[model samples]
Target: SGAAPRVDPRLLAEGIEASRRAAGAQASRLSPTAAPRQVPNEPVHQDGLRGLVERYWDNPLQLERVLIGQVQPGPLSPTEQAQLGRLLVEKHLSADRGRTLSRIGDEQRNYPNLARALGRSFQAGALTDGHLGYLLGPQGLGTSSRRGFEYTGIATLVAASGSPALQSTTATRSWELGAKQTERHAAVDFHTAAMRATGGSTEATQVLLQQAGPALIAAVDAVADLSRRAPVHPYTNRFSTALGTLLTGLSHLPSSQATNPVGARIVGHLSEQHLTAPALRKGFFDYLRSARTSRSWRGLGPASGNAFTQQELLTRFKDPAIRNHIVTEQYYRMSQALEELLPGQASWATFAVWASRQAGSAIRGEPLAGASGTNANGVRAISHGNTLGASEIAPLFGAFAQTLRSNPDASFQEVWRAAGAPNKPLLREAFQNYFEAYQLRRSGGGADAIAERVLVANTLVAQHEQTALQADIDSAMRVQGVSMWSLELDIPGRVLDLNEDLTGQFPPELRYLRNPRARQLEQQFGGWGDSRMESLFNLFRLNQRDAALHGDWVV
Candidate 1:
């Protein structure tokens, strides 16, 4: 400390000049009509104060630098600092402030001082919901892994600064927008990119799982924390839906060595916080109860010509096919969670009973026979005309029962595998059964006529499944003798061949059968499933299971 570090006069001069240049540029942008001004060596004047406030309003970064003496050695006088802070707070309170505050908060470089000003403004009731909302918007939090943490800090700061009303409003809007961005769009992009990188290879997929696991966990944690802070917020439902979507996407990833640890972490976190909690079950059932009476749910998709009353629509929600799809998706997530958390400790019998109870409760209100109305196209029809019989979902239950009977101590994974791992096939079969039953019931036939109709429908479904399976088998057999490299190269052609074999199997006449049941089935499940990705994943799993069962190799 001989001479205490001497300041370089030249460096100090350069720094002041740079600050002047930066301030000038910001001033010009903020107030284009104002004449250009220069920083003076003397005490600040009114014009300088006005220009400084303008710059602060538009660009918080420069203001922060100046305030911290990064641009100049000396701080502003107390009076000038107060004036600048007051003006900035006034801007924050204004309705027309736009997203400038949010941008500054997200920059994070100047968060402490900005948060202080925001806090003061909130204390004075000068900060509006608009300001708080902008600060907590999707743009503020962003979709980057780093931004997720930044969002937590910003949200906490804002929540602490204001009344619950403002805090709740801001949190709701933030969640509404952020949920879609992070859970839907961003998650989809991550999955698509990972899939492309992995090229469907188990090893590559495992690497991706390890890399992305932390970020995924962080995102879910942030959502849970936010939801806890504002439990009554409307966006809470959005958060729940987002969680379900996240689980679905993660479950679709192929199981691998790397995925085991990652999956365990996720499963553990969810079980601790939500999945295994009674609160979650209560919340979900509550939602279903509310949704049953909701106009939106009643009016789902296109309006049918049958023009159902609200009550009729509510009754139709009890349709077995619809219930099966909903229950199966829930069961899928629960099964995956149990597999990772407890492994073989959980029995298939318990899950089967739980699933059955949930499905029954979800569709408990009405019998399918009660629904009589016209079609969406205005033609005469039954209101629940296309509803499946209670027995329609019996095959799926039978599959589970058989699995449990054969292996009483089977884990969720074993039972799932034994039952064909269901997924898209479960929904497809549910739809098939519903359509067949509907057609048979509507055919003006007694028991004998219905029996014959059932036989014909079963034959058709069996034929379609066999044909699809055989086509895949034939393609694999054709390339069995080829080298691995050649086989990889030949897969596209084989896929095309399989498609050709499946073409025209459901001819126009059969698909357009006068029965509404046939038309609805063709329209909904005609392509097998809603998503190509789901269909592909299900097919891969089915092939793997088949090979394991038969002690044979998969192509």
Candidate 2:
């Protein structure tokens, strides 16, 4: 081998010492030295590593070359060797596969395959292995989509596309991936320089819109180019195709267009570029007209049912009112503002006012008497730590209320039973409370009296519900061969009619029921003359006829 270049060991020591001294001095100034606290052990920051690489290599493409030049592949020192194994394993199989990709190249301090393998093996052996093993072992190798996408593509599509937000969010994630490759702060500086050129508020918006429109159009075009180049990346191609359609649509809108003033005299004034001027003219007028005439501002704004999601449009503006009035309120608020744009209308001024009333009846939800279904006692009891315990009573109340609304003649017993009948003790306890309230109303007057009267009405309603329930039961039993009595009952109406001697007297209108022949006719098929109904009718109807035909002492 050629004679190695001679190096002064003392000079190398001095250079290292110099850096140590500098770092120590800076650390002393920046941080107060305190007792060491236990912290998670992590590798040196990638940022620091990258900075060192950039300082030495200067070119990103020359990472491997620079790394190879700086460090020879050999066994690492004790401490370095301990961490080397971990580094290898991390690079090959981190949960986020891209982390390894990010760390590769000149910045990584290129080592030979043997050295890399040793480091990785050490990491695989020394680490806790729980999470790491999950990534590398057979346990995680399954083909389930939740596992490893073992299922068919059709299943994945159905699962993924069910939620609309998830789709948009996934597409928007391209911004994050693209941001990693560029210096964003540098781009902002460029934007700032352009903003300073445009001297007015309106001019700034116009310029921004103009630039964004074309940039977006170009981005969409680039995506189309990518789709053609890489046909296999279907997901990316789909997203790109959608974005292209959106960008194209936005480019044609009025807001994207720019304008310059007719006559310019000022040295630094911005160009006249108010995109909203025309739309605002009609919108403002409509808003003002509706506010003056309409009792409710019902049709003043855009309908809520429109297909477009409003989040993107809202985010584009700073002021909430600008979003609400311009983008959301249709042409109502904007038209009036435009009508005043002329010379004489320049004197016009409008201001929003905020005020409140003492008794704000205008707000819809204020509790009104008889409107709130809950009673005063129920409300009071609710405040006290009392559980409503109205499960039994509520159904009963519902049945009664339903019947009262539909049928006035329904009895209370039927409704009560259907409501899940509570025992007599419970009813007695309820009545006690009712009677106490009734006495209180007798002592107190006005609304109290009326409320007491409602208590009585409630009892009657509940009683009617009970009666209807009994009639329903009787009618059902009669059909099922459980009841012997011959009485025709109307379940809903809570009315009962006599069909025979055992069922008491028939009413004048029901006298037609007295004829046994007529009863047979009434019971069967269409009329009442069916065989089954006639058999039932004979039991009731024949008795009435026999009593009518027989004379005293066989005269």
Candidate 3:
């Protein structure tokens, strides 16, 4: 405290009166209106997009104007169109941007267009599915009188009606729009046109069968042409009958084998389509179940009478043609699963050990138990591996392989290409391998049930594959140090693909669920509700409470 005080002694006030008088004199000379200079906010360099973005990002109206201007510039090229989407997003979203932004703009400037266009195509001259008009038709009147169909909404509707590729997508889109504000009569008209045009696709046909609402009138006549093709639609008196319209449609679609329930073999690259029988079955049955119990069809009036007896439903379900689809679909799933259970490029040698075990199990007639307690169905459950060798089965498999030599997949196909052909023992056993694959959690394949399930599904196996089969057998048998091989596809199927297909079709709301590859819902959700959100979710699944009361197949 004393240190500064020493220098601050009042003795240093050399000019107390002099400074006060001098400062007062100086202040008297200065003006009271003096102000500091100001500078404008102009960038040192020329402003481009980045500068503009940095300048006015805080202002919403100005940003919108910039965005509108960007969209202008006399229509962007297809390549530019794609880059602009990400570029615009980046300019607006300031937070998630940095080096990546610059790289996207610079590195990918010339990349192909990735953003798909979602609308009618001028190149294809495509229209909406069925040009749906309002169903303002009066009750108890001819449908035509009540239907408010019109081609007058837009110049495109009339033009589109004539030049179009019949697809159900637009109609489906309109149905999905359901009263959304942006969708207008144009959407309805487009849907009608699209619906009217589709005769080649099952998707379109199913859309027609299930279609309702204002646009349905427009599709009604188009669907009328399909009346003789699908009998259970528009006027089926029962819920099951109406639902079976899909089967009828499948039966009539061009190139569909009349004997098989499935149409066109769902040939595509979707992994989900190839595997997960349970998920597929669950999805199928769940859809049927929802439709069966729906109080109203498409939210129209009350659903058609469910007056059909349980036995009647069962009878329809058990129809050979219907069951054929069920069985074949199961087999398809089984083949896919078995193929997956095999190996990828991995040599057959890798699978021989497991194959031997399965062969032993098959030979002894003692089914091995799996995680599902007493799961003895073996390959039928996709739980156990398919065995390739045994005293009784090897000879027959060789014979079966002989038949499949010419098939490219070498995988079993579900169609019955040869009718009235003499049955080979291999046909029976091979079919038995997949027959019970679709049964509810396989319902525990009893000896008698197993015997009954060995129904025939002969298509791919034939004389040509004999050499390939023998070669494959020799390759794996060499690995086992004895005779053994996998009775699976030479190629491995992708399980991810199966799960993908199973979940891909889910509504947007369900897209987030953990993709479970269960062959049965019980396998996936069986032990849920004990903890996690399950207990809370149980409240919403009250409908499933009665699951135990019905037969597993029915459930």
Ranking by lDDT: 1, 2, 3
lDDT of 3 by residue, 369-464 (tens): 221122233222222112212222223332333333334233333222321222554445443343332231135533332221211111112111
lDDT of each: 0.36, 0.27, 0.27
By the TM-score metric, which is better: model 2 or model 3?
A: 3
Candidate 1, residues 1-555, lDDT tens digits: the string is 022233453454344345444444222221212332434322324344444544456566766654554544334433334444555644543423333443454344345554445544444454565554544444333424444334433443343332333344444444444435535545432232222222222333344444454454455555444434434433233233334333333344443333333333322333223432232333323332322222212222222212222333234344343444334333333333322322222222112223233223223332212122212321101112112211233344345445554665555555556646655453444334423343444454443333322223333333333343343323323423211111121121222111111232322223234544434433443454433222322222122111121210112
Least accurate stretch of 10 residues (summed lDDT) in model 1?
A: 483-492
Off by over 4 Å in 3: 1-143, 146-316, 343-555
For candidate 2, write residues 53-85 as lDDT tens digits.
Answer: 323222333333322323321122233333333
Q: Score candidate 3 by TM-score against the native.
A: 0.20
TM per prediction: 0.24, 0.17, 0.20
Q: Which ten residues in a row have the lowest lDDT in candidate 2?
A: 346-355
Question: Candidate 3 — worst ten consecutive residues by lDDT sum?
Answer: 134-143
